[model samples]
Target: MNITPCNTVSLFLPLLFFLILLLIFFITPFKGNHFSLFVFPLSLSTINDKNITTTQVQVQQPHQPNMRIKKMTRLDRVEEGLAEARASIREAIRSMNYTSEKPEYFIPKGSIYRNPHAFHQSHIEMVKRFKVWVYEEGEKPIVHDGPLNNIYAIEGQFIDEMENSIGNNPFKARHPNEAHVFYLPISVANVVRYVYEPIMSKKDYYRDRLQCLVEDYVGVIAHKYPYWNKTNGADHFLLSCHDWVPSFYECNPQLFMNFTRLLCNANTSEGFQPKRDVSIPEVYLPFGKLGPPNLGQSPMNRTILAFFAGGPHGNIRKLLMDHWKDKDSEIQVHEYLPKGQNYTKVMGLSKFCLCPSGYEVASPRIVESIHAGCVPVIISANYYLPFSDVLNWNQFSLEIPVAKITEIKSILQSVSRNEYLKLHMNVLRVRRHFIINRPTKPFDVMHMILHSLWLRRLNFKLTNSQ
Candidate 1:
C-alpha cells in the first residue's frame, strides 16, 4: 500500500521469501533412502535414557542432474559413530583426569600404569562409547562354546560374557550400524576340540584342519556381509588362548594381517605384533569358578626368597630348572611340588614368584602370582605381558632374562626390604586387572581385555577406508 520504492522492495522481499519456502517444500524430492540420522551417547550413565547427540544427514537426490554425492551406507554410519568416539577418547586422554558421578572402586595411579591419566581416560571412554557387534555366523561348540575350565578358560569366558548381553553390558551393540568393532565369535579352542585329531601322528594335519575351519568361518562372514570386506578384516577381531591362532595367519595372512587378535600367546618371535594385536591374560578358572583364591599373604610373612613349581614345558623353563632345581634352600625351583604342599600356598609364601615361559609365552602362573600378592618375576624372551599397553609390568613385576637364571636368587636377595615392599604393594595394586570376575567388575581381567581392544580400535580410522 506504500507508494515509496523502499516500501515496494520490503513487500516484494517478503513475497519472494514465501515463494522460495513453498518451492523448496513442494519441488525438492525427498531422498530419505540416501541418508540416515545418527545418534551418539554423550555420557556412560545416560546412554540408554536421555543424554545423546543426534545428527541429521541429508543426501541430495541422485537424479537431480546437477550434483553427484555418494549415498550414506551402514558402513559410513558405523564409521561416523567410531570417528566421534575416537575424537571424544582423544579429548578425554588429553584432559588428564575424569570425574564420574558413579562411584569407582579403583582409580588408576602409581608407576604400575604406563600413563595413569591416559589409561584412566581411555578406560572411561571405553565404558561410555565402545560397542562390539559379535557376528552370529558360526555354530556352537566350534563357534560359540569354548573350554571354561583349566588353562584355556579365558577364551570361553570372554565369549560367554559377550554373548550374554544382559544387564549393564555397555559394550554390546544393539545394531551393526552403531558398533565400533565387529567380533568374530569363533573359538579356536573349541575348533581344536571339534576338529583336531590329537591321536594322529602328523600334527600338521590337525593344524591344517584348524586353519581351514577359521578360514571358512571368516570367508562365510566376509561373503555374507560387507563389513569384513569393507575394511578387509581390519575392524573385526577374535579372541583365543589357543596356541594355534597365530598359525592361522599362515593360511590366510591377508585376511588376518590387520585383524585384531586377542591372544594369550603373545610371543613376538611367533609373529605376535604388539601394535595390531592384543596380549590377553591366560586365566585358569577351575570348573569355570571365580579366580583362584587370593591368598594375599602379607609382605613380611612371605618367607621364601623366590619360588617356582611347574614341569619344564619349554626351553626357558628347562633352563630355569637346570640351574635352580633343588640347588638352593632359598630358591625353591621344583618340577613338581611335594604331594602335601599346596601350589597356591607356596606362591603366597614367596617374596617373588618365578613365571617362566612354558610351551607358549603366556602362563596362568603370572596371574596366580598376582593373586597371591607375590611380585611376578617374568623370565621369558619376546613375551608381551597382558595389558602391558596400559599397565607397566616392570613397575610391579621383575623381568629377568633367561640367561640370568643363576642370578634369580641373587636378584631377589638384592632387592632391599623397601624395594621388595614397593614391588609387593604394586603387585597388589595391579592385581585387579588380572582378576577374572563372574560379572566382570571394572578394570578386571575381562574389562581390561575389552579395553585393550578398544585401544587398538582407536588406533584405526575406520572412516578412512578404501
Candidate 2:
C-alpha cells in the first residue's frame, strides 16, 4: 500500500536493523573462514615473539605379571639342577672303593746324606734307619725325596729328569733303572713370582688358580704322603695329611701329580685281600689346647666365635674386623692362644663357633667346634665337609653370604632368641661325628679314602675280566 515519507523512513529503519543483527551473528570477524582461523593464532605468536608447541603421546603396552613369575621359576629350576649335579658327583666319589697299600717309594743314588734341606734330611734319616725294616717287615714305602738330591743341587735332579721326559722326550726308553723315576722340578723363582707373591697381593689370578687346582686335583682325585711311623710295618701312605697338600697342588698341578701317587684313601687294605666295603668316618676337627675349666664352665655367654687368624689366609678375621669390631668390643678376640687351651674351652663355652676356610680349607677348627657341642658358623663358598646330606646347615648354624656382609647387623637382629637356642641344641646332637680322639675318630678320613680307592680297583679288574 502507498505510504507517507515519515512512515516509509520508519519501516526502512526497522528492516535495516534486522539485517545488521543477522550480519553480527553470522559474519563477524571472530567467525572467519578456515584459513583466517588458523592464521589468527600465528598473529598472536608474532606479537609475543615466542614459540608454542604441542606434543603427541605414544601409548605403551600394559605389563604382564606372568612374565616376571616365569623368569623367577626358570632361575629356581636352574639352581635345583646344579645342586642335583653336585650331589651326584659327590655321591659317586664317596661310594667308590679305595686301597690301603702304601705306594712304593725309591730314593735316587747319592741322595742319602748329601741334601741338607729339612724335608730331605728328615727323609734320608728315616730311610737309613727305617727303609730296610720297612721292606723286610711288610709293604713298600712311599718315598718322599724333597726338592733336593745330593749336597749342592739347588733343584732336585729327579724332578728335572721327570719334567724333561714328560715335556721334551716322550719316546725315551723306560729302562729298569729309570722305571721308578718320576721327579718333577718346579722353579722356586716361578713359585715365588707367580704364586706366593700374587696370592699375597690378593690378585684375581690367585683366586682363579686356587679354585682351578682344587677343582681339578684335590677335589677329584686323592694323593699320597709318607707315613710318619715306619717301624711297625706301616708302609702305607697317610691320608690324614691331605690338608697340607693343597698349597703344593695349587701352585703346580702337573708337578704335584709327578711326585705324589694318585690313590684313594678308603681302599687302603690293612691286609693283601681287597675288602668288599669299608665304613668311612663322618667328620674330623683339629684345634689348639683347651681353655681353663673355669672359663668353659662359667655361663656368661654360651657363644664361642672361633677366629682363624695370625696368617695371610685370614678372611674370617677380616670379616669380623669389618663388621663386628665395634659391636663386639667387649668380647676378647684371642688371635693367638696356646694349643692345649684353644679348642676345648672355646667350644665348651660358646653356643656357636664360626668356621671359616683359610687359603686352603676344611680346617680342624670345624671338627673341634662340632665336638665341643658348639654349632659352626660356616662362612665358606665351598665346604668339603663329608656327610653334608645328613647335616642340615640351616638347623645347626646361620650362613651369612659374603656379598651381603654389610647386612650383618640386620640379619642378627632379625633372629629370635628361641630360634637361636634351637640351633645351638641341634649342633650339640651331631657332636659325635667330629670327635677325633675317640675309637670312632673323625680323623679316620684317611681310612675312608683308602677303602674307596680299593673298591674302585676291584671294580676295574672285574670289568676287564668280563
Candidate 3:
C-alpha cells in the first residue's frame, strides 16, 4: 500500500511540532520559569529587565525575509509604558548623587539601604510613572473595605489610603487602560469577618468558601475583562493581611501562582515567594488612635535590655513563651502585659524588642518596635523580612533562628554597647519607612509597601498566548 502524501506530511507535522516544543522546553533557561521568565517568539518584548512578556508592537526579527506585524492593543501601550519605567528606573538607579531639579521631601540614605541612591531614584520613578487600576467589582466590607483596627488594620489602611486617588493617591489609574498593574481590592480579612463567620468553627468550610470566592472573583474578572486572560493574571494583585491567606492560597494555588499577592503572613514555608510576591509590614492601628504613637525612650534612657509580649499562638511562640514567659525581669517576656503597664511605654524602654512569629511569620510588633526606636529581634524560620528588597535588616535588627529560643538573652547581651547603639540609631532611621502616615509621605509605610510592589512590577514583562 502506497502512503498518501497528505497523511505522510501530517505524520511529520506532529513530530515537527513535538520537536519544537521539546527544544523550547530544554533550550531556554525558562522551560518552567513559573511566571518568572516566560519566553515566546510571538511576544512583543523589550529586554530591559531579566524577564519578558508578550508584546503587540511590530518587532522585526534580525535577517528575517518577512516581518510579522502584531496589532498593538491597549495592553501593549501599558506594557510599553512599564518598559520605559523599567529603563528609567534602572538607568537612574546607577547615579550615585542623583540630585533632581526639584528636591524630594525625603531621600533614602545610610546603612539601612543596600543602595540608598537606587531606592531613592526608584521611589521617584515609581511616583512619576507607576499607575495601579484597583478593580471595583465587589461590594464594601469585603471587597473595597477592610478592618482598619487591631492587627489586621494594614489590609484596610492600605486600601483606604489609596482611596482610588480621589486627590489622595497619585498612582491610582483613572482608567483601566492606563494601568500598568491591576489591583483586586478583595479584602481577605473582611472575608473571614463576614463570609467565614457563620462557619467559624469549620476549617474545611472556611477553606472551601474561600476557594469558591477566589474562583468566582477570578471568573468574574476574566469574563468581564481581557487583562487576566492576557498574561495569566501576572500583572494583577490582591492585598490580604489575614493569616488564613497563606493556607487559603494553597487551596487554589493555580489561581495565585501568577498573581502578585501582598501578604502579611509572608511565610516562605507556606508558599510565599519573595521574587513574585510582596511582604507588607503588619501595623496594628488602634481604632481610636490616628497613627502609631511616638512612645520610645532614647537609647540613653532605655533601661530594659530586651522585651516581648504576645499570646502563644503558633509553634514558634509556644517555644518562645514556654522558654521565657515571666522568667526574667530584665528580659521582660510576657504572655500578657502586667496590670496598668502601657505597651508602647514598655516597648520604648526596651533596647531590643523580640518580634516572634505568632500563628504567622509576620507580627505587628516588628513595626511597633521600629516605631518605639527599639531594635527588633526577628525569631522565626523561613520568615522573609518586609521591604528586604531595599532595606538591610542586619543594620537595624537581629534575626535569631527558631532553634535558638534559649539563646535570645545571650544574643542580645553579646552585642557591644556601641553596636547596640548603632542598631538602635539605625532602627530610628528606618522608623519612617514603617510609620503609617495619612496621605502617605515619601518613604512612609504605605509608600514603602507600594515601593515593594513597584519593584515586583518593574522586574517582569507580560505576554499574550497568541
Which digits, one per residue and each the tens of the lDDT, describe model 2 over residues 208-263?
54335333433222233111111111111212222222344446544332122221
Query: Which candidate number has the best lDDT?
Result: 3
**Native-referenced Cα lDDT, model 1:** 0.78
- Per-candidate TM-scores read 0.83, 0.37, 0.84
- Candidate lDDT scores, in order, read 0.78, 0.35, 0.79
Higher-scoring candidate on lDDT, 1 or 3:
3
Q: What are the candidates' C-alpha RMSDs? A: 8.8, 31.2, 9.2
Task: Give the residue spans of candidate 3 off by over 4 A.
Answer: 1-73, 99-101, 198-200, 203-205, 463-466
Per-residue CA lDDT of model 1 for 1-466, tens digit only, reads: 5499988898799899999999999999643422221222122222222222322222222243333676675656755666666555455456666655566667888888877766776677678778999888778988877888888999888888888856658888888878888998888887777676455667545577777888888889888876776566777898999888988887778668667899999999989888678899888888847677767689778889889999999999999888989888899999988779989988899999999989888988898899899998989889988887777787898999988987887777888989989899998888888887777788988899998888776654444222
| lDDT for each residue of candidate 3 in 410-439, tens digit (9 for 90 to 100) | 888999999998999999899888877777
Of candidates 3 and 2, the better by TM-score: 3
Q: Which pairs, if any, clash in model 1?
A: none
Whichever of 1 and 2 has more lDDT, that candidate is 1
Deviating ranges (above 4 Å) for candidate 2: 1-316, 326-346, 438-462
When 1 and 2 are scored with TM-score, the better candidate is 1
